[model samples]
Target chain A: MDRYAPPGAGSAAGAERPQAEVRVPEIPGLPAGIPDGGDAPARHEGGEGDAAAPEAELTPPSAGDRPAQGKSPFQALTVIGQIEGHVSLPSQNKTTRYEHVLPQLIAIEQDPEVQGLIVLLNTVGGDVEAGLAIAEMIRSMSKPTVSVVLGGGHSIGVPIAVAVDRSFIVSTATMTIHPIRLSGMVIGIPQTYEYLDKMQDRVVHFVVANSRISQERYRELMFRTGELARDVGTILVGRDAVREGLIHEVGGMAQALASLRAMVRQGGRHQR
Target chain B: MLYSIIPPEVVLRPADGPAAVLWEEVEASGARRLILRRDADGRVVIERIISTEPRDYLDPALQPGQPYHPGRRE
Candidate 1:
């Protein structure tokens, strides 16, 4: 009876009580000596509670949990659908409101833990002012930034794609370079044409200033005829965009992230 | 003025009628403010989460287009 008592329970009182040997259900993959919950002594030392502690330490918290600690240092901002400006488009039309993006950009810039930013663009573009405003924000951000043109980055998206520290375009992506034009009823006055030309100049200057494309070549792409069936513009695909000096490289996500990480490391060294 | 590759005719097309969608802002758990709207199937769907905390954006449950049930704690 004394020999039957557990090593921890080594008293006459322990020997008097019935030592019911409890057995844990054998699970296939689990080790043989898993203690049953009803067994107090074994549970206290190496039971469910003790088992869970090491597992919690081994596995990181999921994204749904407190992700701030476990999240990646770099943040990704996707600019897809239409770049919605002042007016909200119909619900059917997918739009990326500037109001939403602007605030998020501010937050990203302010987050000290965030090391860098990667802007993924697949926009058909929208209002010139709104696009330029977004472009300016990305350009002015002190943190290392990179933009990747995935599907298409046409018209106003061109400026935004080039606004980053380095830009990459997937091999199949296409970018349309065309002059800005009024959508609704336009009063056919000389002033209206001048206003349109001035707006176009703004986009041209922004692209030329931030990219390797010369002003003349960009303008040629904008005003070139016989390219689009209806409109006058040049459709640059992948390497053509890199060759035109608009996008920095013609690679996908891998190149973009690698370049951004390198830039972030370099920036961190500089700050240190 | 718009500068897009999409045609002006398609881009500026007028809506058939005013949207009848109902949007409501509700206070969710963890001090999160969520803008919700009912979908076609009558499930309350998340339109957006309005919070200054950047960490809120990382929450998968609070992402846009996800269904939101009131009084349910995840």
Candidate 2:
């Protein structure tokens, strides 16, 4: 049993092997492909039979621990703390997603080595509460932050774009600015209607506060006639969004990294 | 339910796009609050209303309407 004991606190394998296999626990809502808990593989003295042991079986495999399998030149930023996700509410994939990001963002804010944060947006926007919570955390962080809009950053992703110190979007990136939407059972009444208005106000206030744009301008875009196939919002291109004050710039990886570097530099000066 | 007792309507919009509505009117306890979102194709959503007042208002995230805030209890 001692031989199979994990190498470190979280890992099941020891840290002796130059190249090892790692396993991560299953995240509750994420797909099977996304890693769950963090586990690593270690070299064992025994042969075939040891592989069948329960400890080895229980620990899943991790991509990080895999030996150099003739992969392309690697480029990755070490995860300083954690990447939080909240699957409490379902999104497009019918699972509550993005709720966990807030907690992760908070943890990152407190980490000293984090230097900066980068948000990769590809969500269609799930629970507004969860999305806004994560966005607020990102906006409040003293560390420099940057967001890259890829695929789609509709609805909730709008806040995500503004939360960072700087943001970037690929030429093909698309973002939708629409009215706040609600889900669950709804009973129509005057009081209910009133509640809806106030809620919209809150969203507008937050977006205006964090971004370079104004509330009036945002409303105009949200209420656009027909940008979406069947929706009542405008889908702005990278350059168009930047021109409208919704996004800061329109470029790919190079531009994003440059903005991040600038933000990081600014943060360093603030600390001094 | 009674509201903030404001003498006038404080109509404010955040951006120039279609306004996203929030359901539920709770107390504005802190600067940190959650924003809700719906997956593409208008499916699955959740909104938590938090305000620094008695009895929060639970409104739908979509469907255009008026703002719900803390006010006098009826």
- Please name the candidate that would achieve the greatest lDDT relative to the true structure: 1
lDDT of 2 by residue, A1-272 (tens): 01121222222122322232223222112222222221221222211111222211112323343233221111111111111232111110212233234444554566454566677776555445655666787777777777778866766667767777777788788777776544333657788767767766766777788767888898998888866665567888878888888778887667766766775656541211
Q: How far in Å is the alpha carbon of A150 misplaced in model 1?
A: 0.9
Of the true interface contacts, what fraction does each candidate have?
0.17, 0.00
Model 1, position B13, has a per-residue lDDT of: 53
Worst 10 residues of 1 chain B by lDDT: B14-23
Model 2: residues >4 Å from true position, as ranges? Answer: A1-99, A182-187, A268-272, B1-74
The lowest-lDDT stretch of 10 consecutive residues in candidate 2 chain B is B2-11
For chain B alone, what TM-score does every candidate structure achieve against the true structure? 0.64, 0.22
Best by TM-score: 1
Q: Evaluate candidate 1 by giving its C-alpha RMSD to the native, one decimal.
A: 21.8
DockQ of each: 0.08, 0.01
lDDT by candidate, in order shown: 0.67, 0.45
Question: Distance (Å) between predicted and true CA of A98, model 1?
Answer: 0.9
**Interface RMSD of each candidate, angstroms, one decimal:** 25.4, 25.9
Model 2 DockQ reads 0.01
- The digit string of per-residue lDDT tens for model 1 on A20-126 reads 32222221211221112111111101111111111111122133443335335677777777776655443445666566567667867877877778888998988
